[model samples]
Target: MLSRSTGRTRHVLTISTLGLTVALALSAALGGPAAQGRAPAAADAGWSSASPFAAAGSELSGTVTVPARRGRDTVVKLWLSNARLTSVPDACRSTVTVRERASSVSADGRALTCLVRSTGSRRTISLDALVDGEPGQQVDVTVMVDGRATPLGARLVTPGVPVPQPDLRLLSSPDFLNADVGDLVRGPGFWRPGRTANSTNADYRRALDTILDDWRAERPESVLVAGDLVEGWWGTEVDRSGNFGPDRTLAQRKAALRRAAATYYPQWKERFAERGLEVHAAMGDHEFGDNPWRAEKRRLAPLFEKEFTKRFGRRADGSPRYADRPRGSKHELSAYAWRPRPDVQVLTLNVFDATAGGMRIRLDRPQLRWVERVLREARQDGVRWVVAQGHTPIVGPVRSHGSSKLTYEGGAHSPLWRLFKRYGVDLYLSGEVHDVTAVHRDGILQVSHGGLFAFGLTNYLLVDVYEDRMELDLRDYATHWRDAPDGTRLWETRPQGMPKHLQVSPTPFTIGTAVVDGEGHLLDRSGILEQYTG
Candidate 1:
């Protein structure tokens, strides 16, 4: 049910007459960089998304972010470099536009090119651009997409440079089992159900806004949703009297879902849009009626797929964004991949493609085989990193029925896990159990980002990518603004588990970091990142 990426393979470099030492060892307990002896996960093939690192010289570039703060003018620094060029390359000047209009830009190559270190990997490219806008502005910068000009999308401006200055950035979370987040009428569970039962839309918005506020400097590129983006699957909406409500037919439920999409889909879409990230969602159990297989699936499947298509299907120009991706038809909007940058490939899985969790879940042969095909193509495309995302975890730490673990109903050791290892997937982002846990096994990392609907340990993952390494920062949304600037303060909680009786821990929010070396071939240090509290 989840999905999300890395960045460009370019760095700014100048023949550094003054070469200084930089600490390659970021974490304390990490040893020297692991050897790149393992054969490439798969042999490289020609790619559609051009890899600038492939040749000695190409337009090696990073993102240029401009804050869309209407009516005001701001400046942004775009770093660039060409390992093959001693001076400006042929396409050195990339046009800068705002709201699709051309903006004046002046390149400064004197100080920048000189400071770029001699080491090919240690070099950087620098460019400067100015942005002017009126108040309340929301516009885009144009970028070439498949010979077509497309908007670079909006960027939420930030103050200073954030660590792990990656080419592409993303946020991941799952399990949003609610419709009108503000009106998820609480059931007769342990706590009250009504309007204010769990987290209100306002609560999540406010908290998430606070977190983004800190990063208002520069928001991540997009979000990878690990399914369960909605609540109240067909039969789960029964009343206290056990009635399935008046709208019970497959046709009736479809209408209700369409109505819900009108209210709920925009809730998340707008939030993500404002934060400057397009949502690439997954198909969680909730999307499939949560309950076990029934004859109704025949009728319900098409309608459910229709709802997702309506909500997230097309672009403003009527382009079928969802349909354009992988074979997402059966579960439409459920399986797809987007390469934000040539070096990074983002793949989304339909956990409900073949089987819904039984008592435990399986990725049926179709999905498993389909995943392998995608990974193989990624390798053929010269992609250096692959991040496979789904809803249920192949390896999870929490104890929940939906979890795929040794004891959970969602059991493990399926063909999917082996594919992950065989393909050298750097990270498998998942979420079923709400607790934030990152585990490394068989040379692969599985970090279940905390869920959006849960108040307990609600968290998100921020990834920064380099040519040989990627950093996964598990950020706490609740304590992000509450913690001391250093994040040294401790916090605790005792919320009832999703099952209502399970006792939960009171662990304080902390920033967790996991590093992957040589295109995810090795997990450098599977531990927490203590330096950053903000």
Candidate 2:
């Protein structure tokens, strides 16, 4: 009977630039002779006027105004974070870089971007050095650009760390589950203190406030809410006496969700904007609507899509709804891919669509095919690792008779499990079980973020993927903080195994149930099950 959203947005600030040269010295001068008048105040500078970077986050964009004496060719060297190191030469070109305390120099340019840890409370982003020659040859050095001094002043990093995985500091409640407010009675249900409070009122403001404070202390790069951002399907109906009772009206649910989004998501976005922290997101069951494949649920798709477009800033035509882009918006109904750093390529799949909002999980034929396409592309492009994230746990420790009952009994594996296995998916992250569980089945790692806003226990899982190694940190909310809670260390798995590496498997392991023992047997667990009716 469990349901929740899977995946999250892990923003990678791109350090794109052109022109490259050997390391050059940065002049310790301010506002070079090119300045005819006083430079803009710090407040007026685009950096301060726009959004601020996260704790160790910073962004810079400008052409290196070097003297022509170096050569007819002008090059800028941009050093990105060290963690982005890859076996592929220049694999990090023009893409978002996701690492801390690292720098990148453009292969052909003189721009250098780095995210250094905060000294005291301030993080620094500098055009540290300018190089204007070959890799091993001498190059001219210029510190000041257009009257601006080199290594610009460091400022206070806002919003601090991104909340994706769990740390030892804060706990995250599973968010994207299509749970009714009533089901969360035993724990700290996230409800707003207003009339608009209904099924969609997740008190993210209070919850995130707590998480943000903890991040300020620990300084994580990003935060991940996983999926099920909204309860678009609360209006579905069944029986009144059953726990899956008469659902609310679609209008009612929509209004509640709308209010909740209007009330908090903007603030959340603004908070992220202020810190220049990239907010990573993934589609959940609720994002589309419960039982998305159902004919009735399909009718609601437009409405849900509209709301989603508005929040994510996409256009009506389903483009990356960037304010500066166009009339389009960011609408990813199937699959979206990203790279945390040059080494990590994350593919977010809309797995719920396979069920089409019905009782069975099936990978959309297109997405199933696309998964292979994206993986091949990433590998060809020299991606060091590939991680797939979705909302449902295809494999876990929970055992149950497959039932569509509405209260945490949907514990059977989805057909996509084999697809994941075929791909040798390194990490499968999901939320719905309402309890944190990490296990390795057939060399693939499955992590359930579990549920939050219940029994006063909320949590999230953190994962750090290094070269040939990874670290999983699970953070649960401490009960003391009503709004936010403490996080407990749940479990981790980076065990040695057969080259579960990124090599593509010709065939995925079959999707079936495994014996409680480690027999590695496949059971006929296909198809959605009915809810557990005691």
- Candidate 1 regions off by >4 Å? 1-164, 176-179, 182-205, 211-218, 234-245, 248-250, 292-299, 316-319, 322-324, 354-360, 364-366, 396-412, 452-456, 479-509, 519-534
Across 392-456, the per-residue lDDT of candidate 1 in tens digits comes to 77764543433332221233466777777888788887766655556667777776654533333
Error of 2 at 302 (Å): 4.1
- Candidate 2 lDDT, tens digit per residue, 1-534? 000011321222221111212133222223212233655212112222333332321222222323332212222323222111111111112111112222333222332333222233322222221111222222222233223332322223333223233211111223522233321222122333331222222343344445545444444454555565544443343211212222366665445444434543454455555655555555565666554357656655556555655766444475653222111112343346656577666766555432244534435556666667667677678766656666666654532221121221233344456655555566666665555445566656665554434223344444544343444434434332222133221110101111111111111111011111112222211111111122
- Report each candidate's C-alpha RMSD, comma-separated, in the order given: 18.2, 20.9
Q: What lDDT score is found at residue 32 in candidate 2?
A: 19
CA lDDT scores, all candidates in order: 0.44, 0.37
Show model 2 residue runs off by greater than 4 Å: 1-207, 231-276, 289-298, 313-318, 321-334, 354-360, 399-415, 480-534
Say which candidate scores most in TM-score.
1
RMSD to the native, candidate 2? 20.9
Q: Count the backbone clashes (under 3 Å) in each candidate.
A: 30, 104
Report the lDDT of model 2 for residue 509. 13
